[model samples]
Target: MGGPSEEPELWAFLESLHCGDILSGTVTAIERFGVFVALDDGPAHSVFPGVGFISFAELSSRRFEAASDVVQVGRRVSCEFLQFDTWNLEARLSLKATQPDPFQLFVDAIAVGEKLPGQVTKLIPFGAFVQVADGVEGLVHLRELAWTPVETPSDVVQVGDEITVVVTEIDRERHRVALSRRQGSSAV
Candidate 1:
């Protein structure tokens, strides 16, 4: 969602579009949060320059350092329409929707209790994220980080640390992988 537009023409144009429709546009801006596109078939906006928007999370199915890594300003792109952002009066588009999801592919080949190698990518109070595959990061909850009690994920693993983890559970519907470090070490 984004700021509302005062142009009624822009709203009508965006309303004409539906989810899953492929729209081609020129990348008008790339902000920290998302990318804006000037749709070739849509009317001009009075508030924002473009009425088509793709959030960072919708830009790619893979992990990226920045928006530019996946798309650049002035580049032409085709994106799948996700929804009409009535609040922002913009078309919510998804670049990743047009691409295959690596997580689904990873899950299809992995099984529960399978041990795998991964690099600790992030540490939080609740859990640690491990990059088990490209675009596939599994959550190693605070309790799963070690057998003994730990205050935080950093107490067991730091960012960039190589670790072995057991895939304790997989929620296909939610696209989540639950991992356990203690179980992995014990299995070995």
Candidate 2:
């Protein structure tokens, strides 16, 4: 029953659906209520979900303004169809609603007291967001950045520079990771 119209997005998805199909979409809009994603049915087709939702903070690992920066308008994202209403002509889309969080993996992926090398991605007032591994990073808080109180993270570590850190804590429940460098190398 798929036909070309102003709602090609919705129609394409209906045709592709098999009652439990997994789909991916791009963020179309972010409203006060929730985020809207244009379903990727193929060749840029989409579907609108009236009840779908995503938090703005979750859209980005941290800072977010432009949805494109986090969820591109045309980027395909993995999602599952929670439900679809024929009479209302709406669908429910979600990422967390379907997939397990990657951050949670860090809880088991990283081990406490183990040393992992990380790259300084950014320097902040608090510390640095080091990329310890592909998607794993732990904060080297200002207190942990040096043997003594340091004015800034740049003093010892700069962006793009690699540093070794010991896994201080891996909070699985909170999905928080704590890393330290003070224990690995002696300060001179």
Candidate 3:
């Protein structure tokens, strides 16, 4: 006779999953904020739609107009477990983790002082964020915006403006790229 039947075995399988574990699943649903996935050979989550969920930002390494553009319902995907949301009883997953990071590729392909054309995507008090590649963005600090001192970033660049910037620093660990528009200028 079995001491505790297969209950303990089932519990062990569910508990074995840890952060960074790669799991395969089918996309069950898509929402404005995230995607629901029904994991293959995984225990059902008690509160969420399925065993896993992927946030919008975790869906891809490249920017897309919508979640549907990146993944469709019934799409099979391999995702990395980010965390187990114990309160929500959901597995937080990242599809992008399985894919190559575009930012890393961009950094590897370029070097410091290389001028690249980018579009101004956002303006903030400290600087302007420019989209240098499909999913890669670099910050142009206020002091680097122009040769002349500028009180605000908007005074130098505006949203949707096409500009050239030179890579000043690359923080691969933090996935940050510092850029300088002033250095891109031929006058300097």
Candidate 4:
């Protein structure tokens, strides 16, 4: 008689995984959508190199243009297991979940009306998104972009422009920080 197949053993190991468990792995591949990791203590994935995968947004607390900016192939990473992707047979992992949120730290250190140096990260018809701190971004509404009425965000600021902004409001529950460049100048 033949022994039990490895499939049952793999299933047993996968069944043992739970959300929030920390897993160590080596990054085996990086795609535009996410990174694939080879878990050190889990059954090897049949279709992928590793059993752990981190999506782009879960890769870092800070904004990065590419996954390679946060992790490289062969890099060892510690990630929190978010869920088991049954379809893919991979563990959905979060790299940022293991790190402290920079936005929360920024909120704890500052208050409304505080002026901070920020760089414009994105400009939209309604407003501009400013990076006030690492991974911390605030929105400067159209009306707040300048003292005078502006037609568009680009009139006051463009992507990569460095400017001063004042914290107009903070919604801790939502982790949203409203900022104003016009108010910043007045506060100075």
Q: Give each model a TM-score.
A: 0.79, 0.59, 0.80, 0.91
Determine which window of 10 residues in candidate 4 has minimal summed lDDT.
1-10
Compose the digit string of candidate 1's lDDT tens values, residues 74-172. Answer: 999999999988877888999999888999999999999899999999988899999999999999999988888889888878999999999999998
Q: Using TM-score as the measure, what is the rank order of every candidate, best first?
A: 4, 3, 1, 2
Q: What digit string (tens of lDDT, one per residue) describes model 2 on residues 1-188?
A: 23447556665555556645676666666666556666545443333342233555445344345655556444557666656545434455555545455576556565688988888888899888887754566788888888888898888889998888888877776657888878756886
| Model 4 / residue 50 / CA error / Å | 0.8
Q: Candidate 4 lDDT, tens digit per residue, 1-188?
A: 11125456556676789999999999999987799999999678776778788999899978888899899999999999998676666789999999999989999999998999999999988999999988899999999988889899988788999999999999988889999999888632
Question: Can you write out model 3's per-residue Cα lDDT over 1-188, one digit (the tens) per residue?
Answer: 11224444434444678889998989998988899999897676544567688999898978788999999999999999998664455678999999988998899999998999999999999999999998999999999999999999988799999999999999999999999999999654
Candidate 2: stretches off by over 4 Å: 1-78, 81-92, 96-100
lDDT of 2: 0.65
Give me the candidate number with maximum lDDT. Answer: 1
RMSD of 4: 3.3
Better of 1 and 3 by lDDT: 1
Model 4, C-alpha of 140: deviation from truth (Å): 0.6
What does the lDDT read for residue 149 in candidate 1? 88
Clash number for every model?
A: 0, 1, 0, 0
TM-score of 2: 0.59
For model 3 the TM-score comes to 0.80
| Candidate 4 to truth, TM | 0.91
By lDDT: ranked, best first: 1, 4, 3, 2
Segments of candidate 1 deviating more than 4 angstroms: 1-12, 63-65, 85-89, 147-151
